[model samples]
Target: MDNNRLATKPHYQILDGLRGVAAIIVVFFHLAEPLASNHLDNIVNHGYLAVDFFFLLSGYVIGYAYDDRWHTFTVAGFLRRRFERLQPLVVLGMTLGAIGFYFTDSTIWPLIHTVPLWKLLVVLLIGYTVLPVPLSMDIRGWQEMHPLNSVAWSLFFEYIANILYAIGIRKLSTKALACFVVLAAAVLLHFAVTNANGDVTGGWTLNFEHMRVGITRTIFPFFAGLLLCRVTKPVYIKHAFLWCSLLVAVVLFMPRIGGATHLWANGLYESFCIIIVFPLIVYIGAGGVVHSKTESKICTFFGKLSYPLYITHYVLVYFYVAWISNHNGITLKQAWPYALLTLAGTIVLAYASLKLFDEPVRAWLRKKLK
Candidate 1:
């Protein structure tokens, strides 16, 4: 949910920068993923929680930007603005996935070769809409709606939240909104505590459980974020940006608690982090200010890069994961060069796409569609 809220209102620059920090850590999390056998041992263990933070951020920003504008913000207008802001990078992510798909062929995904060219194109076309496809259409073994760009699943849920907001949630009284949030939280708690994995992960696949995971992940934090925006009384905090950024990093990097025997331990931890800690971070970020010229530039640069980096970088990750699979037993030390290359390549590609494709296309869409 690296959305275009800045277009509607003055951004909390610190929040923008903190988002970029989380996105970068997600890259590191994905990098470390290929090295781990399971979630517990993974370095950057809680990085998946970043998606929850993102949903919260999106809700808060959307509420801040649009809550008062309901008098003027039609459903069609809201959807159009959201589609323009989010869909371009989605299409680009899918395109990169397709472009890199063949190069990623390996024992881990040998079916990549068997997939008919027509089916690949078909999946790519479906992916452009950012809608979930059934397992029958899954060309890759992963059964993702956008198999080319697996991350598009979250964007799919993001659209759902937006649609709900535009149609109904925006009109609800604060008390009613609180009730809705409570219901969503119950669902989230049930999902987290009962989940077999001992954590709030697995929302990427095209299955019932995964769909539930996606929805559970989306609704609570999003509504909570909206609630926070509605009820929060601002208080200034010194060094808020740095403090919030460190909090995010620490939460993301913390080692997985509880062994297999105590799965609920980790589940409770994940739920508590999402339900409580992320909101505090967002509150702190929203009340923060740039303290100097250097800090201003830093926030501006990261704010610009956050969305592009999140959307584009995973394509390179697919390549890296494939390479690792093909070279069995390749240690991080042995693969450091390729890992560094993946990181640098994602950053470079993201900057280029922002300048060349995203900004131009958005400008054109705003001219014609808006």
Candidate 2:
């Protein structure tokens, strides 16, 4: 096989950069989570919304790259491709999390000392496959399948989306896809408004309610992105990348709207953001052209870094969160220096993994799989 013939499809470079931007914000948002009494008051309040944006991006990219290729692409081939691209970082993230686990002992996860080494290793092995562990096997008190690495839950739903696409959704006509999107959107609305917290958060743990939250979050944006790809006619825009990036930042950083008295207000806002705002951002990003070499390079770097950074940064967060616990709830002002260090350290670690491990391993797999 000619390696050149197997080159990846061209991406929306600005969208890639925006993905990295959101990933970075998510890191900061996690840092701020310990500070707020609840979701309504948290600084960087809507940071969790980044995952929805990511799902939208994933759908657009997947549909753009592979929808037409299905004439020759098998389910097995698609699954293998996704696994090869994603699994390397998953392994590295779990390994890093495991290495840092003992260091994260604190009040939040008090059972860490009693968790057997064998059980941790078992979770690590399962994490490599992105499989959710049963609650009985949850070594950590949090009931997360990947106890050492909590973020893998989204990756689990990501794989589910890919599997659905490969098996059936990819074959749907544009009209059918639109219908699916509408249905998903309605479910998302229902999930958001009816929740006690009145937001789209809390899908990390493995349970019936959380599973509904996870599926609702996954379906709407993913299908809506695919629908947008099918229907979109690109429009030229000035400074689209900047504008779209700003839109994302503002949406994520906006102070929580509609407090306890008006929970429905926040729910409507989140629903609107996911079903409407995010896809618009992706549309602008896709249609907008890169105007300079520097912008192109930045997008390239971000595209390369986004997944690695998202997957690996939470390991550092575990330590940071534990440090907060050990200090008896340190304020953000007191924690700024260490928080800055963790932020810098995560970027360095992500870059190292991308260059020294992720790229090399992925390249080798592509060759062998070719």
Give TM per candidate.
0.96, 0.97
> Which digits, one per residue and each the tens of the lDDT, describe model 1 over residues 103-215?
88778887888888898899999999998877888877877777898778889999999999999898899999999998998888887888898899978887888988999
Best by TM-score: 2
RMSD of 2: 1.4
Task: Look at candidate 1 and tell me the lDDT of residue 92.
Answer: 96
For each candidate, C-alpha RMSD in Å?
Answer: 2.6, 1.4
For candidate 2, list the clashing residue pairs, or say none. Answer: none
lDDT of 2 by residue, 211-242 (tens): 88898999889878888998997788989889
All candidates' lDDT scores? 0.88, 0.89
How well does candidate 2 score on lDDT at residue 124?
A: 86
lDDT of 2: 0.89
Pick the lDDT winner: 2
Look at candidate 2 and tell me the lDDT of residue 350: 92
After superposition, the stretches of candidate 2 with alpha carbons farther than 4 Å from their true spots are: 1-5
**lDDT assessment of candidate 1:** 0.88
